[model samples]
Target: MRMVPMAEADLDAVLAVQAACYPPAMQEAADVVRARLRASPDTVLVARDADGICAYLFAYPSRLGKVTPLGSRFTLPDRPDTLYLHDLAVAPRSAGQGVARRLTDAILARAGGLRHSALVSVQDSRRFWESLGYAAAAGDGVALATYPAGALYMARRLSA
Candidate 1:
């Protein structure tokens, strides 16, 4: 599978993979996902093969320490210091295939000028993010409260 910028035609498959990867409570409604795509098309990436989309990463440029709430739209800032990774999901078919790492490398390659990166590590996935060099950081508790209790706000410094 290869990672590429997501297109409108890929939304359905992306949403399907999202549903299969995340629990119902963490799932974003179709409308909300649409809004996110519309708001920051350049930041969304999709990986696919003959079977169709199997992995995706939704992210956008934003201020450091800030996060987009679950199922909410994002507005790219005029000057962004961080690349906020909103979601990264891989379908069962793509599991254990290094799909997530490839997509993440694609995002990082495109974010070379950013000062930092941030994400919400949910469902006890902090160890996974930690492996990528992200560490827990103080964030908006109220904003993060919308996610499950295990969610952690994590950040990593980027070479400028």
Candidate 2:
């Protein structure tokens, strides 16, 4: 399999893989995704085998949004050096083969050598991130602001 940076031409295939992997409510709008690629294509990572694109992750170095202040429930720390993992999806056919993990490692490695930590909005895979050393921020509920959909906030420090 090959892990590569996203390109404009990859959008249709990436969108297909994402739709195949997520529910409608969670699937990103194709236009929004295309815009993100136009602005920051390198932020998205994809996995492809001989057949085609199988799994992918959409991430960007993001800031703590208008959530509660630090130390509040679900409040993320106010730090700019954080990588925000927006989405991680593996094709149903490719699930359970460590595709997500591999994609994550590739993205993190590309984040350069200057970052405080990486964060992700987690929904069904709390255990998965915890296994990777992520945990609920000190703050819990009120601090998290649901985007288009509600998801829990978790973070992991990139070990230097």
Candidate 3:
């Protein structure tokens, strides 16, 4: 029903939504999730209704070409020029309700002067992201090897 900055108390609900939204292989451990929030509390957000948390977005500031390996802790960069959209998940019950779009819009609005927004698309989500202005980057497997075979590194230039 509403979006709010993620809080430590919201982790349990956030993890539950994440588990329901992603496959086992794609889920991050609770510690890693906590680390990411600690690293970028400003960018992480949660959408909750009277029932509980239904969606969440975990993003952070980072360099243009840097990649956060799947299932790893958030690695804060010294000077980040890009807003890395590390994870976005909506519970099955919340699907088709535009929760992702709202969260993404809020995050981008918060990006301020960041030059770009980037993310890795997994589970054949390229089309969904592409519709939001993201484009797949042509890169060697070596750079994206940490992801599942079909994953892609995608980016979108922001309008300053």
Top of the candidates by TM-score: 1
Give the winner by lDDT: 1 or 2.
Answer: 1
Q: Using Cα atoms with residue i matched to residue i, what is each candidate's TM-score against the true structure? A: 0.96, 0.79, 0.95
| Candidate 2, residue 132: how far the Cα is off, in Å | 1.1
lDDT of 2 by residue, 39-150 (tens): 4466688899877888887766554333322222222334556666766788887888898889988988866543544454545687888887777764235544433344
lDDT of 3 by residue, 1-160 (tens): 9989999999999999988977888888999999999999999999987788999999999878778888887787888888999999999999999999999999999997999999999888899899999998754456478787889999999999
**Candidate 3, residue 123: lDDT:** 83
Model 1: how far residue 143 lies from native, Å: 0.7
Q: What does candidate 1's lDDT look like per residue over 5-112, in tens digits?
A: 998888899889988988899999888888888887888999987798999999988988787788778878889999999999999998889888889889988885
TM-score-sorted candidate list, best first: 1, 3, 2
Cα displacement (Å) at residue 33, model 2? 0.4
Clashes of each: 0, 3, 0
Residue pairs in steric clash, candidate 1? none
| Model 3 ranges off by over 4 Å | 138-143
lDDT of each: 0.88, 0.67, 0.89
